[model samples]
Target: MKPLRKIIFPAAGLGTRFLPATKASPKEMLTIVDKPLIQYGVEEAIAAGMGEIIMVTGRGKRAIEDHFDISAELEANLKSAGKSALYKEVSRVARMAEVIYLRQKEALGLGHAVLCARHWVSDEPFGVSLADELIIHEKPAMQQLREVYDQTGCSVIGLIQVPASEVSKYGIVDYTTEEGGLLRLTDMVEKPGMDEAPSDMAMVGRYIFTPRLMQLLKAVQPGKGGEIQLTDAIAVLAKEEPVYGVLLEGQRFDAGNPEGFLLANAVIGLQHAEYGESLRKSLQEYL
Candidate 1:
């Protein structure tokens, strides 16, 4: 409630799935097309009227900080080259919002990453977005969850129906009732097995949680991977308060892995206004 001014981004992962590329650079910095994966999430949050950005980072993630900071040299060089449009775009990114970075110190888990921002959030409802999950929609995904949070005055997590075989890969939700795209969650389990899975509706990376959820996260012990799981905390929250699962309407890309990353680039690239036509023609010829 309190107008959802702050959102947290958990960008501390080592990104081992990307191998040598991620060895030096962060997986979040991997570009979808022209912009980095993280930038898309930041732009979406800004579009949803959340101006305060709390980035939870870890060791070897200074690039994430520098990416969002003002670059005087780059801007000056672009201006001198008479690239006014490019200069404005770079300048706009730096001035997008008030960004606050918190070092996670260790690779705990999503729950721990979000818990690190509790002090900054300070008793207000906030949002959590995993940068690797690239969602393309007419209405920003965060805005959609915010709308639900506003109406229910409760925590809301974005949901997507995955295949039964892939259910073990995500936190599956069991709903007590459904109204159109919205479901009132009864229970949720993290990475449940196919046979034990409550439902095929899996939790995505978008979340708008109440301050109380922070308290619940603190109480959660490490689950399967010895990491404090956010789903574990959300399950407790559901038991005490009303938690809603919203089936997000969008094109989602799990750009954390190589295949997904390449797919995201190709798909999103073909939709870019200036480059889409050229890229489409190029792909057609190549194929």
Candidate 2:
């Protein structure tokens, strides 16, 4: 088991859920507070000691690359304006990690997006975090998965117990609980209906994958919507090896959708330094 050294962010989705707003810009570039969604995932990866950030991007996603690149003009302008703090902040984004971008070319699906990064990930274990999902925890969520990987050397997926009625909204897991809170996943179904759902423990976007998982992805045929779903690959992988889903100890937000995006803003905004207090007071008055 090699130490996880890389993280892959699948950022090529069309973001149709966001409509015109995401037409020109990527959903990942939408800001939660002051930082873009992708930046949060990058920061989380860095915090977990994963320095290489491989972004599986697509067309119209150049904004993500630009956001992390050195903005010489903007940096100089901020310096000339005597905004030293702002200059330092802007400069840090470019230096966050060794970011490598690979174009997905086509919007196949999450599993396909991960497959595109096969060259970069090579033969080592890696982490995958969807730019849209934000997990607020004491330790970075991926770090938690890395710990599990350390102990079991098994593939780990982050799980959140959603309401039974909402099972169809996500990939639900069927599992057997181990001594720890870890669930040894026996099966997984993508977006199963309420009656078809195996369990309410929905798979969130964070995952730690062994190299062998890529083989499963390659063998998996297109699923619903004619897209290669990552969940389908994971389900097959579970049959031959142990696939563990850890109940993440934190708040998870599906920031990919407009509703979830707004909720993220409100929740994270309440903790913002410049506006949190004022925002809280205003919300109190408005409510």
Candidate 1, residue 108: lDDT: 84
- TM-score against native, each model: 0.97, 0.96
Superposed model 1: Cα runs more than 4 Å off: 178-181
Candidate 2 lDDT over 108-180, as tens digits, reads 8889999999989989988999979998888989888878888999999989989988999899999998886
- The 0-to-1 C-alpha lDDT of every candidate, in the order given, reads 0.92, 0.91
Q: Which candidate is the best by TM-score?
A: 1
Q: Model 2, which residues run further than 4 Å from truth?
A: none
